[model samples]
Structures are given as C-alpha cells and as structure tokens.
Target: MGWLFLKVLLAGMTFSGLLYPLLDLSISGKTRAPKPNIVIILADDMGWGDLGANWAETKDTTNLDKMASEGMRFVDFHAAASTCSPSRASLLTGRLGLRNGVTHNFAVTSVGGLPLNETTLAEVLQQAGYVTAMIGKWHLGHHGSYHPNFRGFDYYFGIPYSHDMGCTDTPGYNYPPCPACPQSDGLWRNPERDCYTDVALPLYENLNIVEQPVNLSGLARKYLEKAVAFIEQASTSGRPFLLYMGLAHMHVPLSVTPPLENPGSQRPYRASLQEMDSLVGQIKDKVDHMAKENTLLWITGDNGPWAQKCELAGSVGPFFGLWQTHQGGSSAKQTTWEGGHRVPALAYWPGRVPANATSTALLRYCSIPTVELLESMGACRLSAWTITRPSTLLGEPKLVMGARVLSNSTLPLSFSTWKTMLQKLRPYREEAPSTRRCCQRSPGFLQMSFKTLLMTTAPERTTLRTLR
Candidate 1:
C-alpha cells in the first residue's frame, strides 16, 4: 500500500495546553470537564480553488475567505481519496478506503455501505456522550443497517447520494441541462444524454424519507435550518456535539438561487458558489453565537471538482496536473492527480488555532490530528500503543504525518497493529461480498517513492515521500 504523507505545520500554542484540562483529568482519574464541541463541514465535489482565500479569482466564497482570515488555512491539505464514498468513509473512520472497505462511489441500489462493523467517529463520540448529528449527502450507504441513523448518528437529514444521481422535481442548472422528473414516472429514460431519470432523489431525515424527488432549489435552505436547530438543541441540552455537514453544493445539478439584480448574468457555477458560501457563513455565525469559545469548526472538501461538468464544475486552481492532462483524460475528480484530491482546508478554534496563520504542511482528511485530539479529550478509547499525542507536533512545524493506502498484494504494516482489535470488534474479512467491487485497491497503489514539494516560504522547505 502506498500512502501520501503531508507535513502539517499548525501555528498556535502547544496543542497539549489546549487539551490540558481533559488530559489532566484522565491522568488523575477525575471526572473530566465539559468537552469542546466539534463541527466538520464537508463540501461535495468542491475544488481547491473554490475558496476565495485559496484562489484570488474565486470571489464567490466571501464567508469562507473571512474564515481563512480568522483561522488557520492549510496550503497542502488533501482528501484521502479522489471520489465521494471513499473520501467520506476515510473522514469518519480516520482510515483509508483500504481499511474502511469503501473505495468507490456507492449506487442507490448498493446493498451494503461503509460496512456495519466499522466503527465511525460519530459512534466513538456518541459513546463518549456527545450528541452527534449528520446533515446532508450521506453517500456511504442507504440500505437497512447501513443508514446514517444506524451508523451512530443521533440525527440525520440529507439525500441518500449525490443530487444528480436521481431525478428531482426541479433539476438545477448544469452544462448539459437536466430536465425535471416526469409527473407520472414510469421508467422515464433519457438515452440521448447521460442523466438519471429512473429513480426519484429522496430526501431523508434519519431513516424516514421526508420528501421523494426533493426540491433541489430549496434543499440548501432546509439543510441550514436543520443544522442550526441541531446546534441550538444540543447546546441547550448541555452536551458537546458533533455536526458533520456534507454539503450538496458545488456538486453537479447546481441548485442556486438567482440573484435579484441579474438572474441570468452570472455563471451558474459562480452563483452556486456564492449560495454555498452564504450557507457556510450562516452556519459559522450560529456556531460563533452559540458556542464560539469551546467549539472547533473545520471545513474542507470531499474531493476535487467533477471536470466533466465543464462550466458547472468548481475550480482546481493551480493544481493542473500537466503531466496527466498531457497524456489524456481528466486529472480531476476520479483521478489520483493532485487536482483530484488536494483540497482547501481551514481550522477555526477562536483561542486555539492562530488567526490568519497558513500551514504549508501536507495533511490528509483520513489521518487528521483532530482524531488524536478527540481521543485525548475522552472521545474514544484506543489502544495506548496506537495513540499519537497531539503534543508531538508542538514546535515541529515540518513534522511528517504518515498513513497507508490500500494495495493489491500487501496490507499496510500498521494494519497488523489494528488487526486484532478490528477482529475483536467484528470478524475480519478479506472483503465483503456485497461491496467487494467497491473495495478494490486505489489506482495509485504502487511501490513507494520520494517526492519533495518546494515551499514558497523563504528558507523553509520540507521533503515528503509516499508511504508503503
């Protein structure tokens, strides 16, 4: 297995001090104080250039730009995988697609999901007494036990998969525009063009279908309302919470509200970007108002933009992947090129993460230090040998963080360390029969190699290599 290692340089006080309260309590065998809340906002198919802070040309993400100024922005952050299901699986499990058994997009008819046995971050937090909620685009799986509600989320609201995967009452703008669902649907097919017209996109609230063929235009507002409500309720209940919002914005079939002045003047993608930014701003405002002091707000994209969508797709900024593009095919989204997985990331914790700080260290969504930080805060109990303290990177701005990617022949060396525990939790299988196809090794899985990234900052540079 080959893993991409990125060095993370966090500019702030010693991270240990930030969690001293919880660590001290754990060591002294005392009841821990209130734990800080955690909110992870994941954008669907959003490109690295979508954030105005990351790309000067992107003016739509005003709220996100302000967030970068108020927090630490990572210049070399990446998603674990280049696609949806695998990326999301990695985020929640802190494991790559190989370990989590999700390496591709799941269909609406997928009989399985992220595997019922895999322990999710939500489950760990829930067990630690945190109220966990997931709002928007639960693409892991929608079948029976694989649903979000069964995956340890106390509340779930969103679509089963990507918005364009099914027909909706009002199909949003696209490069090749998609039509609305037929009023009386009896296997409505569009053979001339590539689009889903058979199944109706269903809006889910927990296990129940709130609305079949969801109104794409109004979905973003609904997500915002539900997110705010959950935050307020969890805050009032006096419990720390975890809100994992998987936004549908920046994805295909862009459902953006038209501007009042000129409805058709702005490009649909830019308009949608603005709408997404506004939604993010609202959510951030709610967090600031209710739990600004003790909450950590982290935002990043699941993967790169879907380049096939052309004008409707987001921007990849300067990660053009000339080497790959020169050959043939797209280097975005489904590919393992830098443009496919390298995403923009921002971390905000009012008094913790330094404001306006930029970290050049490479970091991936799958093995973020936040998981270790959460563990230190009594979120979950992992084996002592496997625990990496957040304090390790206190003064080391160029420290390399390593993780293993799935390969065809060999399992990760670290997998042996986790094997026993994983087996104890659930029977270890080489691959699940239902999702075996989806669990194939990543395309980039090959022998390890050394690759150095030259930092733009003067006199400070780091060398990175692929881990195997």
Candidate 2:
C-alpha cells in the first residue's frame, strides 16, 4: 500500500564548530556558542510554482533561486493551514489553528484574535536574548492583547490585515471589481466570514495607527525599507536578532514600483512577484555584508495563491487549488490539498547549510520553534502550558475550539540516538491500539520517519505513509 505522509524539515548551520551536537554529537566533541541572527522573509499568497527555480514562466527570482542552490531546498515543506490567519497562527505557535483559536481570518469587525496565552516564536527567541522585529501584514489580530507588539515582537510595523479590504470606491472592496457586478456607493458587505466591512485599511507602527487607507502601490517598498533598517540596527547593536519580514505582495491588488511595471514585458501581478525577488536579494546582500557566517536566512510563502484570482493570484505548479483542477481532483488555498499549504522554502546559512542540497524530509511551519531551539542549541526553551476555558464554536459548521492541554517534547541533541529510539518503538506498533510503523527506506538530504493512523469508516481510506 502507498503510504501518505507529511514531509517536515529544519535547516541546520554548516558551521563546523556548531554542527556536532545538533545532528549527531557522537561524531565530534566540539560545541560552539550559538548566537546566529535569523531573518524570515514570508511572502503573502505566493505559490510553490511562483519561483523561477520551481516554474520558469513566472518572473525570474534569481536571488531566491541562488539562495536555494546555495543552501538547502525543502521539496516537502508545508504550512499548517491553507488560509492566512490560521496558517500564521500555526506557524508562530507550533500548534494547529483549531488548538490556537485562530481557525479563520480576523475581520476588522470581528472580535477574535490569536489567543494571548499561546507562546509565539518571537517570545521564545526574545527569552534567548535576541531582538525581534515584525514588518508587514499582521492578520493575527488588529487590537488589544493580540497585536504584534503585545504578542512578542519588540518592534512592529505594517497593516493589521489583508490589503484588499476597506475601500470606499471599490465595490465589496474587491480590487479591479467585476464590471458586471452592480455598484452602488460600493459599501456592500463582503460575503466572507471573519472579514471586516469595507473600511479604510490602516498601517500601524507599534501600537499606533500611522497611515489610513495606505497607498497600496508602495506598500512592498515600504516593508522592505523597514526590514533593512531593522536589520542594520540589529547588526550594529552587536546583538542576535530575528527580523521577520512578512511581505505584502503577490497577493491581490498587485502593486510595484513604476520602473518594474513594464506593461509590455511584465504585467502588474508578475512585476510584484519580481519585486519581491528583488527585496529578497537586497536582504541577502545586507546579511552577507554584515555577518555572512553568523546569520540564518529563510524565504517562503505563507501559503498557496488564491486560486479565485486567476493569473493575479500566481501559480501553484503541479498542485491544484480551489478554482484550479488537475487530472480529476481539485485543490486550492482554502483546502487540505498539497497545493494549498505546500509552499517553496529556501534556507541559507553560510558554512552550516550544505550547498545545493534538496531535502524531502517532512517539514511543517509548526516545527519552526524546533528549528529555532535546535539551531540555538538550547539557547532557548519553549515553555509549554494550557488554558481550559469554555470552547468557542467558530468557523463553518461551528465546531468546538480551544481548551486542550498541550504536552511538550524536545528533540535529543543526537540524531542517531533519536533514530535508534524510533527503531525500537517500531516493533511495538502492532501491539498498540492504533496502527503505526516506521518506513523501510530513508530519503535523500535528511530523513526521519513518522507513523500516522487514518481513522475512517471506509477500510480502504485507512492507511499510513513514510514521513522520510
């Protein structure tokens, strides 16, 4: 039987001094103090096929392609969810969206936000003596305890939610509104749940509102400018930093600098993608110049494109989405298909990450803290706790949410030790109530096996896959 599995991965530094304890400590006795700087460039609604390395027809992403070739390319990396708010919640907390109470996007009128009780990656890194800054879209929550600054980031700058909202002129706040749709003062309420009314979108600097109805055309450039400044400030302070550039580009209402918007060659949407590539290159150049060997850089999309937007939303490569179909099945940004959450990830850490390596290992955004803690070599710890409050029935079909206790586990400092333990546990699977087993073969780059049980009424639907 063909086993279906989720591929998760974490990139380690290639530094000889810090390499031993992370992967396999028995191989070497040396351990260096880790103070590596981290920069996460998160693209909004970009697809796996949007990169030049993944799909040729899209704009050339020379910098990202170069980064992928230089460091490690994760072919099977996945976000926790297909949509923005939920996926972002999972990315930061390592818990599923349902568990975090952020199962859907937060509308301006909506009272929901990422629960303040959950621990974010920023909080973990902050405790580790690293400065953290957040730039760009922060859909987690717009107000109160859920704001970025309140969450963990020492500095926050960007919009509170998606860009396509809060427009008085655009009907339903739909950019390039459908001509056929009737337009009357354009104040029509959006059909989607958890979305706000068409009010002017505001840009925030920390907790204060800086710009209302922000100039959508120059948002990307603004995000980049803030990111570079943060990097420079952190680098000059001689402190380890986490620069989280949550870019707002390649999403709907595509915008770019005039020079990049060559009408004949690159469409506005494609230009936005290219512009993002340039931003990535700029960040890499800065990092290389400042501390090439002491920094770990990551570039990836939050999730797949909004298939409903057609070419404006970008491409998802071989995978399918909500509006797009491949063969006989359908997959899209809001679904559980690979095209929805499987995004392209590029990790570059000079000397530590192998050159031009591709890893098919199962990697999820939730494992980010694992990577952060492991990369820092116990320089930080994720404090695990839970709150058992009354469940809030949210999302479609109204299901119970939150109020579950979380048990935390840590990865061993030795890979071989963990591998042996996994092997020993393989034999006990048959005796257990649920089905579970390790794979017979390992994968290229880095390999780790995980067992999964599929509970279903149909016997044929029940199966497992090799995670490695």
The TM-score obtained by model 2 is 0.67
Q: With candidate 1 superimposed using the best TM-score fit, by how many Å does residue 94's alpha carbon deviate from the native?
A: 1.1
RMSD of 1: 15.5
lDDT of all predictions, in order shown? 0.70, 0.61
Count clashing residue pairs per candidate: 3, 18
lDDT of 2 by residue, 38-156 (tens): 78888888888787655545446878877877776654556767788887776676556656687788877766689887777777667667899999988898868888998879999
Best by lDDT: 1
User: Model 1 — which ten-residue stretch has the worst lDDT?
Assistant: 447-456
Q: How does candidate 2 score on lDDT?
A: 0.61
What are the models' TM-scores? 0.73, 0.67
Residue 129 CA error for candidate 2 (Å)?
1.1
Q: What are the per-residue Cα lDDT tens digits for candidate 1 across 94-187?
A: 5678866998899877888998777777876676678999999999999889999998899999998999888898888775778888887367
